[model samples]
Target chain A: MGLQNAINGIPLEWYLIVAAALFSIGLYGVLARKNAVAMLMGVELMLNSVNLNLLAFWRYLAPESAAGLAFAAFVFVVAAAETAVGLALIIAVYRSLKSVDPETLTQLKL
Target chain B: MTLQQVIFIILAIAVIGSALFVVTTSNLFRGALMLIVAFFGVAGFYVLLDNGLFAVAQVMIYIGAISILIIFSVMLTRGMQAMIPRNAQAGSVAIAAALLFLILLLAFGPFRLVVDLSGVPILSALFRTESARVLGGVPWQFANREVPETYIADFGRALVDLNQFLLPFLLVAFLVDAVLAGAIYIARQRKPAEVIAEREAIAKEEAEELAALQPQPTAPTLPQGAIASTADH
Candidate 1:
């Protein structure tokens, strides 16, 4: 898509749509992937997609609001820590059960 | 095509291909590797969006730390030679395909994408005219009504200062540490009792061998002499 809008020449909607697509694809991955690590990747994808949305809106819609950028940064940090601990738990589970398959991790399954 | 368009195409292709591989690969380790590629693709998208900070963080945190951790966990628990189960729903593949098609048909049917070409020139001008020092420089208080150009820096400062994120930040750190400690504890707890028993057995066998090797009384000469005398008689 060619440039369609300018808030003094910014294309905000395009970024938003792209972010939405990324988020949807991530959702699909999370639903379809069986591996816990892959699921974590999906979660990361979703988070990044959201970050993209936030940054885009910040740049185009609220150029003065540094808050969006700050939130994205915070999101990035949380994502880093989340994956670390999540993968650690996955490793521990694998050690005990010899598989990282989500189906086999039925300890909490009803 | 424009540079942005070309980069977008490449990143899109990378994202889709890697995502497919992540789902389709039978090997979990390979799947994890493909996930790294997908993350890289997303990070590229961040770069295209003019968020260089996010791009670097994506690679360093996701590709560098998380992917390696996943691979290590996979290797430690499952040997490289272990074969993951094949997709058992092979027979339902067609059904799934049909369902996916139906979903796409319904989803894309209603959406008409409107392209606006006028915005590009304005955006290009904004990008070209904006001073790097003002737009990308460190955050500073502005006396003017318009927001300062250092958006990212301002955002960073806000996180630690205005938004009161310090508590959540510390909480997240504590959570991570607790999880790490718990995982280590669990892994240590799962060591097979047989391993300890096997070590003890090996030690016992070594001790017995040492005892048997000790020096014995020298009766060999008497035995030889008795045998010779009996033969002569």
Candidate 2:
């Protein structure tokens, strides 16, 4: 019930393992989903996992320094911007092609 | 196991399971919802890591804004919800992802190389640690300390201080401004006639979907915003 015990009880490796699994799942989503929006969702998952890793490291190894938290914050902003631009591009693509499936939008295929 | 460990396990399971569902589901709408669940789990992790600020940020940013954008895109492209091939190389991709996970586990988990790779100059230089032994072959050699109460305030100062993250902060600010303007431009560039046509087509498609379903007495009403947007034509 001690605060220190609660904070440091969990091993850092657990966070890393969880992040790895999350990243892999996100990879599958990004590579396997044909829908552009679904792919974007996968990317978001990967970014979240990265944030988890950064923050976990910060907590376990370097809580005194603000480097990890600052990096994670930057990641948050980037993820937000990425989603906004990605969805906008998806919408534009759908408007032109009447679909969001990346497979059929092969106009750029050489 | 400690209470924190138990909570960690539960959070991890919830996150990974929902993430799996988000990736594998053919229904985009359902996937988006599950993605939000995964985000909530990650936010819980942030809280467990003793950083409540990020937990709130995770909920606000990921669940609030990003998930809404994803769901909106899902709705905007509705008819292709089901029956589309999820992917042609799904099996191969799954195998590849599993392999990648295994590799990551070996690197980050308990089953790591026994050799003291920290002796290598290159590895030592990368992690910026002196006399630090790599644990499980990962460059993780730092004594844990209790987080100071003023760490959040320190984080804010670090973000603005020129010697630290100010440059990146300003760059990100510029990036966000550009992204917002660009997104609005990209989404709004359609011709008036084209937009009207698409709205009508969506309405017609909804009617068709309803017709295909069992008849109901209640008619679907358009949103007031949709009505106003169309009226701008």
lDDT (tens digit, per residue) of candidate 1 on B1-233: 56676677777777767766665566777877888888898788777656677789889887888788777765675643254433345335435544553443333222332233334665445543333222212232222233355756766666566355656656666776876776566555544687677668878988998778754554457878999999999
RMSD of each candidate? 17.0, 13.7
Report the C-alpha lDDT of model 2 over B29-139, residue by residue, as the tens digit.
998999999999999999999999999999999999999999999999896787564788989999999999987887677676444646787876766554344545445
TM-score for each model: 0.63, 0.81
Score residue B147 of candidate 1 by CA lDDT: 37
Interface RMSD of 1: 6.5
* Docking quality band of candidate 2, CAPRI definitions: medium
Question: lDDT of model 1 at residue B97?
Answer: 42
Residue A50, model 1, lDDT: 82
Per-residue lDDT for A1-110 in model 1, tens only?
22443332334444555565566656655666666766676677778778877766665556577666667766776776677677777776765566777777778867
User: What are the clashing pairs of model 2?
Assistant: none
lDDT, residue A101, candidate 1: 71
